[model samples]
Target chain A: EAGVTQSPTHLIKTRGQQATLRCSPISGHTSVYWYQQALGLGLQFLLWYDEGEERNRGNFPPRFSGRQFPNYSSELNVNALELEDSALYLCASNDLGDYGYTFGSGTRLTVV
Target chain B: AQSVTQPDIHITVSEGASLELRCNYSYGATPYLFWYVQSPGQGLQLLLKYFSGDTLVQGIKGFEAEFKRSQSSFNLRKPSVHWSDAAEYFCAVGARSRGYQKVTFGIGTKLQVIP
Candidate 1:
């Protein structure tokens, strides 16, 4: 089975621009999550979506937003990106019935 | 809120030597614990998980972790280290929120193996 898949493995954006990263969950998975892995920041939860509904979100600015499609694929959008937004944004899926998440390789966003 | 802490930021072990990575968590109720490994430039892979039942659980690549309720800790261990084992290790605690499970990951412990 193909694990979670992320697009554009790496992305570069200018400061104050908008960036969108995409993720496709494994087959039959209904829940999708977004996380940010930055230098010194570690892995921080960003958002959670299940059944195409935003279930929960982390302690981030309103500029950080995302949504899940009916197919369970997810997109993370950062509006007016700052240099601090430069980080590896990882996407994970919840399907094992437990909380054990299968993560994608992640999209490395570099804000210049 | 649930939080996980990996005290060791980085560790270096010689090949064939034993290894142990410490992790501690704070949660109001019983915690669902997990250990994941991520190679540089790669995504995270599940090593093992413990929701309940056994205190000790075995995972991929000959890795194991023991959960201690009293200590509120879950530490990963390996009898013998391998060079390929060098990677960033993360510990996480899972909790339910809004009918979906939310996981909080540790700062991560980077392992360096000396051949």
Candidate 2:
């Protein structure tokens, strides 16, 4: 089966602009998660979506938001991007009954 | 809240030498522990996970981790270091939250294998 896939491997946006990243989870997966892997901050949980509902979110500001589509695909939106907002955004999905996740290659967003 | 801690920011060992990476976690109950390896510009790959029943869990790519509930630790170990093993390894913990399970990852420990 195909693993989780992310589009626009690289994205460049100016400060104060908005950016969107997309992810397609593996087949049969229902839970999608977003994480920001900054230079040294590691994987900071951004959002969690299950069954097309936002289940939980991290401590990030409201500018960081995302949604899960009916097909289980997910999109992460970063509004009013700041220089610190530049990082690799990763998407993962699990069966909801499992203990592990399959991650996408991630979208490298660069805010200049 | 669930969290993971990888005390070591980086580690270096000679090829064929043994290796160990420390990880500590905090959670309210028995947590689901996991180890993932991430190559440069690549996504993370699950090395192994400990759900229950066994303290020692074997993972792909010749990796293994032991879960110590008393110490609240799950450390990854490899019998022999391989050059290809040079990468960032993240320790994670998963716990029930908001009617669903949420995972938290550590800052990650970068491994350097030398000849």
Candidate number achieving the greatest DockQ relative to the actual structure:
2
Q: Which residues of candidate 1, in runs, are more than 4 Å off?
A: none
Q: Cα deviation in Å at residue A36, candidate 2?
A: 0.3
TM-score of chain B of each: 0.98, 0.98
Q: What DockQ does every candidate get?
A: 0.77, 0.89
Query: How do the residues B1-115 of candidate 1 rate in per-residue lDDT, one tens digit apiece?
Result: 8999899999999999999999999999999999999999999999999998989999999999999999999999999999999999999999876666878899999999998
Please give the range of 10 consecutive residues that has the lowest summed lDDT in model 2 chain B: B95-104
- Cα distance off (Å), candidate 1, residue B40: 0.5
Question: To one decimal place, how large is model 2's interface RMSD in Å?
Answer: 0.7
Give candidate 2's total backbone clashes. Answer: 0
